[model samples]
Target: MNGPGKIYNTINKCRICGADSIVDLINYGEQPLANSLKKHRDDVEQKIPLTLSFCKQSNHVQLKETVNKELLFSDYIWVTGTAASTKRFAKEFAQRVIQITNLQSHELVIEVASNDGTFLVPFKELGFSNVLGVDPAENLKTAALQNGIETITAFWNKNVSEEIIKKRGRAKVVMARNVLPHVSQIFDVVEGIRCALQDDGVAIIEFHNAGTILNELHYDSVYHEHLYYFSINSICYLFEKYSLYPFHADPSPISGGGYVLYLSATRKNKSKSLLQFMEQEESNKVNSHESWNRFAERCVEHKRLSREIIDKYYGRRVIGFGASARSSTYLNYCEFNSGNIEAVIDNNPMKQGQFTPGSSIPIISMEGGLRRKPDIIFILAWNFRHEIINLCRSKGYRGDFIVSFPFEPKVIQS
Candidate 1:
């Protein structure tokens, strides 16, 4: 049960531009919460209508339905410290931010939705101890506090920003990583950012690029928590509404490929790279409704082909790899249960005894999963395909592998 009562709501108007009409790109049907894993296989899961949409007026993509924010994030299991890729990126990101902004050690820095303070530790490592982490998850806040990072257990809103400004003063550096899309109250959060940031301060916002999601066919990323899939134009519109101007943009390794945008209150000179990137978006027609319709067509085709490939190896001993949130979306979308996949291997110990939502596939430890010695290793965490493949090889599991992304979905042999 999703709490005691109703937990779903439908949004008719565009959250960004207040448009009355929007285009429905893809209907995923009823889907479970991507991160909500069940303790037992028989445990019932809540399913909600999952539909992706496009706002022609704002050129932004968002979900038609929204799950309650408290239910989705109050007590969370996903942590940034679980992945090596994220850890390495945190270090690199800190270095880049410091170099670009010349951030001083005395200046206050805050990170929104700072899971386990993975990104904040790097700033401290560079002699910047005046860092704060704000998040809604109690477990994650506790974890970040244990790491000696100051964290506030609260959702980021205009009120919270005003409180922070009153207590800690306005921040010189504010970083929001992968949190903008999850926010249903987009305007409230943007206003909070504006209130919390100094006029000259730089706010770093990193999000999954909508153009990449369309062109790459990363449909598995469409989950309830992610309310919006922002294109560069859409993000610019959102920020510019609050008098924030993006001056620079860079590529990020997160979610296959993402964008790290630097914004400030003052309209400084925009970087050449930022201009070129927006021009490329225009050239690619990334924000056009026709492109979205074509993407929907490709999604339908990818689903058919992927299911065909999965069925072809149905008779073999197939083991699933990486019980990630994205894996939940892919598995449930394909309707794969414990019958098709023996068990899912996850590095996170918290998920080891849990069953995946909707699909009911048991999650197990990496060692236990490898010991089964299956004929095929179906990698659901396709973004870390190379990393998972290397780890499996090092563990002496020489078996055939299957990857579901970059479309047409291929199988590689040992």
Candidate 2:
């Protein structure tokens, strides 16, 4: 389907195995780019196809459609430091990386998709004197540099990795956190990781666990930016193809609960926990088409329940709690119209004046949203539901706060 801006094409072959066994999992229809918030009412909204598919051969679940990299990533707005989950994860991940790899002061460490150098800040403070970040977003690069983090304003690839190799030798640790899903060149990114590391170095990659998504029914996590979902099996399959062996992985509390895969060039004994996790996926029918079909059905029911609650409070003064990318997917999928939501409250100043992508609900400050004592508050960032509700109650708001999907639709009194 052609959209208002650039048209994207759907792929027939699997991105990992190069097999023409891709099967349709679900489609979210034409959606405006998740982070494309607008400054004006008449701004041109760029809608594109958002789809999910799975490979029958490799059991890899990915998007059939591909958006232009520049259109999606250039001048990016989502920063890693914005969310508490990400901030906490960065510090913990830095320490975990040190312990896992035995990283030293002189040994170099590199991070791809290192937005605002949130992760690199700790790497610098934790004795890794040589730390570098590779990202394409100019705004984030500027912020990273201001924080005394050395960053290259480029996407990670074999060429860029070779350049890093030439400039500052092979790195001991290459940390890629929650980046594989956004990466367009699957093979190239893996090859770049392989090329960027020393023979003994370990490349740690983190991915949102497919098991969590399937079990928790996090359909909001699916959007244009995320091109693929990863399971333990899929991670192993892709790495082994490039002679990189996956030796260790843990379901870490990074990016709202994800699996961290530790890969090296040489073979090592797979941890018992990693093997057990893979077996759990098999038992859960992670690769079966029926699981995906049931997931789609569940998602539809979730949306229906949301609309039922939202439709009840028709003319009430309702404001969305978080103006996040996930909120964009939720609003768009549930068809939450502007008349129902007065404004979206956000702590991020960058989003305050802009309007949400598809919904066009104006983004306002916390003060502005709370000033009128809204009758209904819709919590869009469900992951931070506890924090949001507590904040509302602390601010003297006793009205009911609504948490977004998967959970049964009910307004909680603050």
Candidate 3:
């Protein structure tokens, strides 16, 4: 949503740790919605101002604007259950929580920003008497409820947190996977968690690790919706400020090129293992301005290499597969307009009739690939490359698949 000379401003200091240290890492300029690729009868387009900024003081990467909450969450289209990897991850997470915490049947396990009950279903099946999912996306919450998962369709702020605490008491285990960075007010979210969590409660928050994002040159993950890219160094500082401490952490490959952190609230002192991990992260200089510059250079290199390959293969029609949010970063950063990618293909029917947010790439059904027969299919959602390749092959679409991320541009034949 552009206007006449509208300027997006952000604090010079880190939002999480309140440090004056700051750095400019990646700038994707103005981009459209990554997953909002639907076609309306009116044929009008909606665009949002997008940019990525890094906290030099704490190494937390985030967006520069405070987008409308409604625009960010109310009618979210992305469903967590759509991806097999996510479903499997959720199942594993639930099982581990049950084992580690020795959670009884009467105990509660609540998940914030739980989309479509993907992560809550397993916990419910395990006979947890109280399983609650708090999400701002009304549409997704409705879907979760319909799927037999009990959920509250509201934003997880201090007010909602107080209500939950008053009614159901504090939660034993609160899981917020891939949600923290989307929030603009970091303090508010943490405070909400503090208010609702039991004295011994553990709040595991998994987000795209800032260290891995910079190291792997995942500039595409930088979008307006994702306000922050967290690192252990930054997150620990925030935890200390809010009385929530980092007791344990296990890095996992969940997002495309990102890592997840598991945190909790307790009076117990920081474990030696946790201290060592923090030391290692500091020694590696994951939050330095120099490291951010290197990441920016890599972003530029990726754009150049990807554009050159696509231009060379201009004779063949290019189509994008996977309507993922990360795909927006890839398309916008690389400047893939209508001329480069003919359309996008997604397995989810909800996205089939929609167009991509910023790029305006018309989203088509998986069958569109077989019918249209594009010569080069770009796997924009590169994380699921293997599964996508198999899907395409099964659908009888034989073509070179292009993967753009973590590594350079390459075309694989299947």
In terms of lDDT, which candidate is strongest?
Answer: 1
Deviation in Å, model 3, residue 395 alpha carbon: 2.8
Q: Pick the candidate with the highest TM-score.
A: 1
- Which runs in model 2 stand beyond 4 Å of their true positions? 1-6, 406-409
Model 2 quality (TM-score): 0.95
Model 3 misplacement above 4 A: 1-9, 19-21, 38-48, 257-260, 267-280
**Per-residue alpha-carbon lDDT of model 3 for 1-414, expressed as tens digits?**
224343334556667767776666666776665555657523555555665677655567667655656666788888888878878877788887787566778877888898999888988777775889999888897899887888998888888889988888888888888888888776888888877888777877787777777777777787767877777877777767878777666656677644444566656666576677678778878877787777778788888999998897776788989888888878877778667888889888888877776677888888875688898899988878888888888888877888887767788876
| lDDT score, candidate 3, position 387 | 80
Please tell me which model should have the higher lDDT, number 1 or number 3. Answer: 1
Clashes of each: 0, 0, 14
Q: Summarize candidate 2's per-residue lDDT along 45-74 as a digit string, tens digits.
A: 878777888888887888888887888887
List the global CA lDDT of all models: 0.89, 0.85, 0.76
TM-score of each: 0.97, 0.95, 0.92
Ordered by TM-score, highest first, the candidates read 1, 2, 3
